[model samples]
Target: MVAAYPDDVDTLVAHEPPINAVLPDAAGAARARAGFYEAYQAKGTGAGMAAFIAMTSWQGEFTDEYFAQPAPDPAMFGMPTEDDGTRDDPLLSQRSWAVTDYLPDAARLLAAPTRVVVAVGEESAGTYTARTAVGMAGLLGREAVVFPSHHGGFLGGDFGYAGKPAEFATRLREVLAD
Candidate 1:
């Protein structure tokens, strides 16, 4: 974004971005992120996905105790236990780490001719992504605007992880309108 539109822009709405550019707990977050990869390497896709799920759903700060905890069963989260013979779990796979570890150019953003609105879900308060959103906004000297539902708030489907997309859109429109 900084490269493409550094001189001309209006508003940027970042929703639950894994931004650690100015996070106070950057090192801790990095360690916690490494734990997911460790789980994948040490165990298997199932265990790694489980750890990834736990990491994203975590309520508070990542700690040593969090890393020391056992991985939960994938079945509990509707994940199959049978060896699917597939390593592409998408979000939990190795390819996603670079995106997660991406640190935005804070200086470029701060000096940009754009208004940035950091957003997080109300239902996602205290979770890892929510914290990141808040942290990113703090770096911009603003507060994260809470939307109506969880991370998938923009999605409306009966996919078991459904969120209030209508209300989320309403809130998002409100934020963008500002």
Candidate 2:
């Protein structure tokens, strides 16, 4: 929105956007993504989530060693081993790849009047989204603003992955106020 209608936006806070092109090994990330999707298609949500977790939790770049690792077991992550026989998951499927594959236009963003604040969770250090947030900030010549909790910091307990939503909101308010 900032790129197309910069004047319309006052402040744009992009929190941990998973833009793979920002990563050093974007191709490897895509391969890793395919690995998870294959797992989802072959097995189920459990296996796919396990692979996704493995990919996201990886500390550094997706190396050959990363690919060489054994396929993550759904049971290891307390996920169901049985296949639900359904696909079309927005997260585990190729449908969401466009989101991660987007290459931000730095020139247009920099030229915009909107204050583009790229945010990363404090607990998301060294993770894929964290790196992307930093990279996005770098593209705009700024540092990522650290928020509380993990990737879904602003989310409540509804998703079974509760974060510091109150604190996150407070911090967001602070940033927006600035």
**Which candidate tops lDDT?**
2
lDDT of 1 by residue, 1-178 (tens): 7536977668888899985544576777777777776766666677677777888888777777787787778678776666555666666666776767777777788888888888999999988889999888887788999998998888878777889999998998898887
Model 2, span 1-178: residue lDDT tens: 8988989999999999999988888898889999999999999899999999999989888999999999999898889999988897899988999898888999999999998999999999998889889988988889999999999988999986789999999999999999
Candidate 1 lowest-lDDT run of ten: 81-90
lDDT of each: 0.79, 0.92
Please list the Cα RMSD from the true structure of every candidate, rounded to 1 decimal place.
2.0, 1.3
Winning candidate number (TM-score): 2
Q: How far is candidate 1 from the true structure (C-alpha RMSD, Å)?
A: 2.0
Q: How many residue pairs clash (N, CA or C atoms closer than 3 angstroms) in each of the candidate models, in the order given?
A: 0, 0
